[model samples]
Target: MRTTFDFSPLFRSSIGFDRMLNALETASRIETVDNWPPYDIAKTSEDDYRISMAVAGFAQDELDITQEQNMLMVSGQKAGEDKGEYLHRGIAGRAFQRRFELADHVKVVGASLVNGLLTIDLKREIPEEMKPRRIEIAADKAMPKGATKKIEGEKHAA
Candidate 1:
């Protein structure tokens, strides 16, 4: 069963959130999205994250990781090889692509393929201008030398 929602009403009132809403709509419409190459997203620290995917038969050279804006894409393509004889092919060796929507300042730090697991590390490094800052309120008596001088009210011709 598939459920549909009307986001037109939200679009009317919200501004600059079209991308977010579009992402949500895309997620909702993807009913048959494949869950191939199982993955896990973990928060290793306050600003650090890790995404680990199980790539049993894939090698580091066969995988590609890219970041475009706030989206992270990880794809794997099994290298072409001759499969001679196989009685029972149980382990699924298939190509897959996975995408992750990251927050504003999130960035990909590094990635590593170890023991059939491809782990990608991420860190959120907020810009100095965006980070919370403490404003120092100036006291009336302690004003700076040039700033202390006040001018009388004067009218200017427009």
Candidate 2:
């Protein structure tokens, strides 16, 4: 069952949150039954993240990881089918695909497959202009360099 949330009220009162609201909406509509090839997401640091997936029986060459814009996709394809007949089969070696949504400015730095775990590293690097800065509060007569001033409903460069 899928639950729908009404964000019209927030859209009417809020600004610059359309992207966040869209993400929530998209997440809510995702199917809950496609949980194969279990994975874990961890925040390694304030701006660093790690995604570890249990991709056993898959080799590095058989897996593909791609990042386009803010979306990341991971997929695996088995090379050949097993020839031996087993009484009990536990390990799964089937082709699978998984996707992950990345935040703005978050980039995939590296990835490694060790043992049966596939680890992906990510880091968020904010641009210099986007970082917070302290603004100087000048006196009435004091004006900062390259500042703009308004006079008679017209903006004047100062």
Candidate 3:
């Protein structure tokens, strides 16, 4: 079954969200999803994340990881080799490409491949200027010099 939604209405009013809307449109139109090379996503800390993928038989040289803007792409291609004899081929040794959409300020910190597992680490680092700040209100300086002065012709009631 396939489901599609028209997002042209949103594009008419929204600004600077072309990538996000396009991603949604693309996702909705994908009829057959390829879930090859199982993967896992985990939040290790408040601002840290980890993405681990099972990529057996693929060496580190054969894998490519790239981060562009808010998108993370991980692809793997097995080096060419001869398959002399094989009675049963169960383990997947195929090429695959995976993508992940990340929030703003999220960045790839590190990556490692160990025991047929490819792990990618990410951290969200908010800029100092963009972080929440506390503003100090002036108690006296805010008042005008003559704000509290009584009128020259006015008589004091007290």
Q: Against the true structure, whose TM-score is highest? A: 1
Candidate 3: segments with Cα more than 4 A from true spot: 141-147, 150-158
Expressed as tens digits, the lDDT of each residue in 41-120 for candidate 2 is 99999999999999999999999999999899999999989899999999989899898888899999999999989999
TM-score for candidate 1: 0.86
For 108-133, candidate 3 gives per-residue lDDT tens digits of 99999999999999999999999999
lDDT of 2 at 56: 93
Instruction: Give the TM-score ranking, best first.
Output: 1, 3, 2
When sorted by lDDT, best at the front, the candidate numbers are: 3, 2, 1
Model 2 misplaced regions, further than 4 Å: 8-15, 136-158
TM-score of each: 0.86, 0.77, 0.84
lDDT score for residue 28 of model 3: 87
Clashing pairs in 1: none
